[model samples]
Target chain A: MPVEGYAGDGHFRQTYNDIHILCQETAKRIKTEFNPDLMIAIGGGGFIPARIIRTFLKVSDSPESKPRNIPIQAIGLSLYEALPDTSEEVVGKEVIRTQWLDFSTLGDKNTKYGGLLGKRILVVDEVDDSRATLSYALQELQIDVEKQLKELKVSEEERSRIREATKFGIFVVHNKLKPKAGEISKDVAYFSGTDIEDLWVDYPWEMPDILKHDELKRQDDEMAVKAK
Target chain B: MPVEGYAGDGHFRQTYNDIHILCQETAKRIKTEFNPDLMIAIGGGGFIPARIIRTFLKVSDSPESKPRNIPIQAIGLSLYEALPDTSEEVVGKEVIRTQWLDFSTLGDKNTKYGGLLGKRILVVDEVDDSRATLSYALQELQIDVEKQLKELKVSEEERSRIREATKFGIFVVHNKLKPKAGEISKDVAYFSGTDIEDLWVDYPWEMPDILKHDELKRQDDEMAVKAK
Candidate 1:
């Protein structure tokens, strides 16, 4: 995530506070709405709120902060995971592991369970950087990844491969970093590219399971095509 | 801001299409990088990309079809103004004279030239019924005002005031809707709340002088604060 520097202005503080409030609201909503079995938070700087919410859950007595049955897992895709550690007491129960996997380190073949395989994983990283890495990683994991890669402006060869792999259920985070002209694709889950503070509520999490199942089917169809 | 139901197993097209690709990219960096800009966008939703960026300038191209400039006039206590008629031809600018006003509307007293003031704006129809109305009207306006309102969670009192107002500036169109949270405070040009999507980039033509001055002043003071 990019940080804007504004001399002595309280912009940073205001921004942080805004993000914190959003985090609290999101936590509250999750508690009220679809109480998922797991919250797989992807991306790096975006992980701050997840960490804060985790801390709040551990300490706050608010009704909204009551103990949760589901685990909130923070996954960092880069070379390192920078979020604070989970409370030892909550480990394995409330909060799960904060694992950092270097996809670059993983060779073509799968190494272990931790290695990307059929596991339903969410890739969260800056769109540009993540696009390249996600495409490559999913391909190596033998999972189909789907994305236009037009924003990344990659070559046709790369685009074709990504399309082929995406047939295996890989998805991308959609939203804009700045305002521009064009229609937003209705195919994928998108959050506002400009707004990072409302990640909890604004980002679409209500994706239907049928879509995932359909994506899997697409992958199967593609594989069958290749076989033919 | 039309919400189209996709039947392709949930996987549709890219949300940011091609025209607003830069906006999406810039927003990502804004949230991640420390780049400087007077205004910023923060939030997530289907319509965020165009709403946030279009508030800055108009782009004329495919997908975005009618692109026009929407300049920023001022940022003050929960209020922002996109100068009237600032948007260009491609985007077909239409002023949505809303029937709602809130505490943010009070700040409209600052609009000296022909701008929003003391307008009988419509507060959202009662929350329950209002959702449908907002959805309908917002769709007509081509902006998801309801989604933005939901994300904003404006207080009833504020909503009543905005609704009772006599005049106001409204922007509407119909492509993608970008709903956001936070407001520019009424007193200073300070932004409160979380997830701001900087809209200054879109309206390159009508950058508010006051905002520039305030920003510079804020920067100087911040320097002093940091030095202390």
Candidate 2:
């Protein structure tokens, strides 16, 4: 069973409160450090956190300022399979595989109207496990921006603005860095809420079956304690 | 060409500020009236409004209150083509053809445990035109709940609770009612931000081309006023 290797002994368990505080702090840090013009959230896991961040970034509460409405972009990217862990395997072994289900361009009108060009962008996700997903997302974003620039018939000034835009990566949790060769590029700045050792982290939003297993285990633990 | 018939003449032109106020007001109304256990937002259009509503309905600001972390669901229902005006005819004719490209079941853990079984649900969208989309969505929700009940082997008490749950529809703009026979059931209550004529409403999130058309028309209107 996948739960057999549960590292519950001293693993850093995070509750919803922990994640929420982290998001608030991360938003503040990003505002001071990066001051990004656009935020791209990796969907599914990143959706809720990204929304919170956008809310904090709102300048005004009024509706007339349509431009002040939260200007975040969402992209769906799924890139992991439950293959056997092979840290000790030979270099030739398949360690991880990726899947890109939907790669639609940014649909937000603000993003289309020269928002992404020549501005700082922050890509947010819940976790940076193995960094494979984030890496692929950043590369794809570069391609998307370049494609948009080619299609847009804009002035030379606008072209320069689009060309000079920078990108950054952010996460709620960052496992202790082992620093694999050429996995994440050095040019992209990275931000994270908390750092931890290499252990399986059980998030609250896991599938129903896994959640049921977790509940059962908790009940069993409580029963054993009472018996003792 | 679609902008030719824009309801700018004596039309209820809404700025971002106006929409924001309406969303807050609508959120308050839903709270006092229905007090829904869950909010299912129609993606793209309903996303921002739903988020605002969820924030207003927050039970607490703490992170530990997992239940209050906006227990909302997203359904991607795209049934429109072209720019704006066709929403009455071509879009209206095909509004019933809802493609659930991402019909993810409600994942809020509380909803899974008991909330959804016998709870009030609010389905939110930006506009209710001809009532086709909202009607189809309500029908689909009924089907989804029934299917869930069938799959889960619950006791008779739980089954009854699930059956007793109700639904409500909400929109930012409700077009003038030209009620068709049995289109929107009388049983289902609906709330709206405002009501306007059957003329096409131009939203701020329009595409660049449509926005440009609006801007050019505004310029021409100003030029005519200056000449007069």
- For lDDT, the strongest prediction is 2
Candidate 2 has an lDDT of 0.52
Count of backbone collisions within predicted model 2: 7
Clashes of each: 89, 7
List, residue by residue over A54-133, the lDDT tens digit for candidate 1: 32232223565544222233232332212212100111122212233333322233222122322223332323221333
User: Residue-wise lDDT of candidate 2 within B93-199, one digit each (tens)?
Assistant: 45422223223333333455442455577777777666666767777777766776776688977776667654555554445544532266666667887765665
Q: Which tens-of-lDDT digit does each residue in A76-139 have in candidate 2?
A: 5544312212111122223221222122323333455553555577777777666666776777
Model 1's alpha-carbon lDDT is 0.28
- Superposed Cα deviation of residue A62, candidate 2 (Å): 40
Each candidate's DockQ score against the native complex? 0.01, 0.03
Candidate 1 second chain TM = 0.22
Q: What TM-score does each of the candidates earn?
A: 0.22, 0.46
